[model samples]
Target: MAAFDGSTDYDVTLEIPVSIGGLELPNRLYRAPLLEHAGDDDPVDRLLDELEPCAEAGVGLLMQGATPIRGREGRAAPGMTGFEDPDRVASMSRLTDRIDAHGSRIFAQLAHGGLRSMEVWHAGYRRRNPGLRQRVVSKPPLPLRLADRLGILSIDADPLSTDEVYELAADFGRAADRAAAAGYHGVHLAGATMGIFQQFLSPFYNRRDDEFGGALDDRLRFFEVVHEEIRARTDVPLVTKVPAETETPWFVRESIDAEEAIEACRRLAEIGYDAVVPVGSSPFWDHAIIRGEFGSRGFDDRVSRGFEAAFGGPWRRRLVELAARIDAATTPFEAAWNADLCRRVRAVVDVPVLCVGGIRGRSEADRLLGDACSMVGMARPFYAEPRLAARLLAESDATAVCESCNNCVPPQAVGEPGVCRTPAVLKQRGEFEKRGAYEREGGNRRRDSDGPKL
Candidate 1:
């Protein structure tokens, strides 16, 4: 398909080099962040195994999944590494060297899970390790608190004091400094997806009356302070992911809509952010971020292990699962789902705008790159095909094979590597493995007999 007016080739459009905050990337395709779940094992090696293939295949940019800025207390799930470890600099240096050797720029995504921390969500974890409560911007909404009391939700939260807010922002800066010292090309702040930044920015969470809350501009002060702190420590290019809470339930009146999100991006650009990634997200975790068919297999597998550990009990687990199914039915997969938001943000911001939602095919990506966004990104697709960029850059008709089953997501909360688990995809990959496809050609080669195709 043509990129624009049947004049520009889609392949050429995707292959075009772009500069983001002075970092000249080789192409417009990037690997969006998804947890690797390296566990207590050698995380650097596991991360290298998961990310090096994308870099080696000529992916332009790789955003390492959310790494905890603090120690264990900051992790959202198991297997997440952090910057607080003394050997983090050396370990990260090794990772950066491997990606840079392949000429791919890698950015460390610094994050701190606030309300979404495992301490709040995982009953087993919290019980096993006491005294480490999940930190929050303020007390959770009344409904959430009531749910906790009624045994419908497991929430143990510690509201951050006014001074603690600044301290957490400095932690972000310190993480950025460590990332720079580790030889990363840049740092991507986890400003969305229920992280600490989102807790501050989303009115659903931040009810504080201090300078960090109340008005939208006041809520955005946390991000501004974080930007200042990072800049004070290092000069690396900074990128952030901001959520447009477009999918909030109808009953939810106070949320960040498209206009507010656009203004937020404008302010971020003004504060010297190199680029912005605008995604459709929710203050609460559901399938909105990775919208698709609910992976009942993965969810059942996780819950059957021990529902009480994650959810309050079997009944609560069933209720949550039922809600997820309904949510999936309401929000089915739509390719390039964030294109409209990216277009809106791009219209006003002078900086590059990157987008990632359900962009699967070359045509969809080309359409977005033609006018909507400066760069296109995908997360689960990389899980299905690690060397996806090679084919995407080589063939204009290329489409990722990820079925969007969402099976790769649930297992991560239980400390499993984010790899494609769809049986047909796995069968195809196994056939390729037998033929030594990966060893011979970096897994980019495709045969007509390669089982089922997407």
Candidate 2:
């Protein structure tokens, strides 16, 4: 509970202020946008229940994970909650109050799955063609190598057109408007994982030859339109998650170089974005493992800080000061540094920074304030235990730990609403075994063939 042992200067009140548009935030700690397949039909409301716990955990900003804006997609998971209906808007409004009671601001991340949409898979494959052969478009199609990329087992991809693109952007804005109406602090665009945004941005995915394709500027147009719409319609903050660039063992072409990422960051700043979060394996490496590995070590932080460094503008300056403050702390990672990326963004433009990934301690909170981060975010750990942030700040003796179990990693290891199945989460989930049956099946089957969690 006490940030320090009377040794270093540690501030417990992580109520750091950050400004986005006209909104001022409380601190630098946040709950990363984590998807909880808690739907209208589920017996338990997964993410909705975590709001208060996360607020109690002292999260100044608590943002939920990618909730779809388009209702047509249906439920990827049997009970996935969505923002497509007016009724759900009221439900979210009530949910926001639960988080607000804890003094933490709440936001909903709006998204569309695009090519990687699980709904498309479920409906196209599971329901329509369970026994169909694999089908995929090869990046470099050639003899003897037709099946290069993993086939998603679906025949329902209708390449998006410019009009459709515009429509979707508006849909995103509409969702943002709804979230704002629901009293969310902000709404972030889920641009990662070849999501709708990323697919448009990446040449690997987008085949459009119109104004929405080609150059990076062209590719980023779809996002710009959506962002502009959100800003024009609502007063809520806007944040985006981008992949950083790194080239260690592999080369990531779309992975924007730090400098390019900075340029993009500056562009977003100019566009009036509150924060830009970069998540993934070294942004430098084109090789992303498991569709979710940021490498086991630095992962998200390294990409975030490193990218901020590459873009040394007003945004960079804010992030730098914030980073200095976070580097001063003794938490699992540098909260300020991660937040600094946002602060630096704030300095140049009129916005605040929000850091995310895997934060789970007050040490992180102290660092966020001490460093200068407007807000820091916790994801997987928080996903496993909704009240995790509260326990770290209020319960001094509480030594909660994320076993780094891959339960929360979706599409790569487990299913949606990844449960906490690590020894710790298992103890918490009670039905960890039942929940982790998939892992057990994969692990058991793999052991016979000498494989891994993939």
Candidate 3:
């Protein structure tokens, strides 16, 4: 990675075209993957409605949020499109076509949420569906076991055998093949965010002595095998999200640190991953990734209605809420939080390194593109302003209006679309109604008052 000497012009630096695995993007700005809860009813249309605006607004690359490679069994939440279904994959061509028409490349982000799946998190759902169990790389951790014992979280899981691991990797390959058939320009593996890949890589979860665990090289075998599987099935460019567990609970001594994560990124590059997005994350679901103060209404809604199934009883919900408040206090938002981690990863890997995390303005994006990374990405900001790329790409000093209050996050747990719930933001766009801006709506359609200009 070349160091910026503060002499290059920001506009020129950000506008320079970059290529990843023979796929060329028009500019260095990308929309990072954020789950679009496209419901089962016309899911393809809903996905297109959510993503096309970003492409039309001139985003260089768009990563469709974590799509389950398998059926409902691997889903992290409700309303995710099942790429494993051939019929569903075929319908996704319309989305790909529209995005391409805007000259923007879209990548299908394939993922399976291991222990983080609803089977482990949503207690009521687990109770209603007795057969559903979370698939894990190893046994459930102490906290999870305690939670289950205390009736806080009901969880049942089976550790994947070595053979089953290979089968799961094959599923990833099949998903990539489906993505290629659907006309996506590339594939992005959701390896971070405590997903299945992270379960294998992080010692906090991987407690096996087989070929797929123990040393760092062995722990990385699953990813290498998945990469091989994808390569065998499709020739599209592959990108992966790598988590640097830089922040973890005080008791967690086995988490992957920044150094190990950097090495992991280097290994992924060697394994032929076209690009790596190294992010600052924790072993647990907390504010480390989506950093910001919690919105009171959002938190209340999450506990009272949205995530009632996830947190279980009243006492358990209160415990989880306390934990979340503590997390927020400890992990406050910082703009360009991942820039240093990305810079470190870039120093070793020959492939493009993408940076994302609390980056909200042109100056931050420009500085990152100038020296730290090959591309800069923003996720939550896109939820606030779907057509954000127009201003980001065209203006010299544009900044997003999203306050990063995290008000839009909670509803997704219950199948709601990602939308701005902030009163001021909605009012500014003239979408706030008497029903309240945070009210659950049937669809993700923009109101008459909303447009690309916002």
lDDT of 2 by residue, 1-454 (tens): 1111212224423433444555555544566766666665431256556566566556567767678777646223333467887667766767787777656677788777664454334432244434432221112212112211223223344565567677777888888898888888888877664466766665555456788877778768887999878877897878887644322223223444444454566677666666677543232112231122222222134334433332223454344335433322312332223443444433443344455554456665555444434455667666566655545544434434555444344222113344554555557544433543112111101012221100
In candidate 3, stretches whose alpha carbon ends up further than 4 angstroms from where it belongs are: 1-12, 300-303, 429-454
Worst 10 residues of 2 by lDDT: 438-447
Count of residue pairs whose backbone atoms collide, per candidate: 0, 30, 0
Q: Write the per-residue lDDT of candidate 3 for residues 130-222, one digit (tens) a residue.
A: 776677899977876887887766667789999999999999999899889989999999999988888899999899989999988899999
The C-alpha stretches of model 2 lying farther than 4 A from their native spots are 1-13, 42-45, 74-79, 123-152, 245-254, 281-350, 358-361, 364-373, 394-400, 410-416, 424-454
Model 1 C-alpha lDDT per residue in residues 197-220, reported as the tens digit of each score? 888888888899888999888999
* Alpha-carbon TM-score of each model against the true structure: 0.91, 0.68, 0.91
- Candidate 3, residue 240: lDDT: 97
Mind sharing the TM-score for model 1? 0.91
Q: Could you tell me the TM-score of candidate 2?
A: 0.68
On the 0 to 100 scale, the lDDT of residue 409 in model 1 is 74
Per-residue error at 119 for model 2, in Å?
4.8
Q: CA lDDT, every prediction?
A: 0.81, 0.52, 0.81
Candidate 3 lDDT at 103 equals: 81
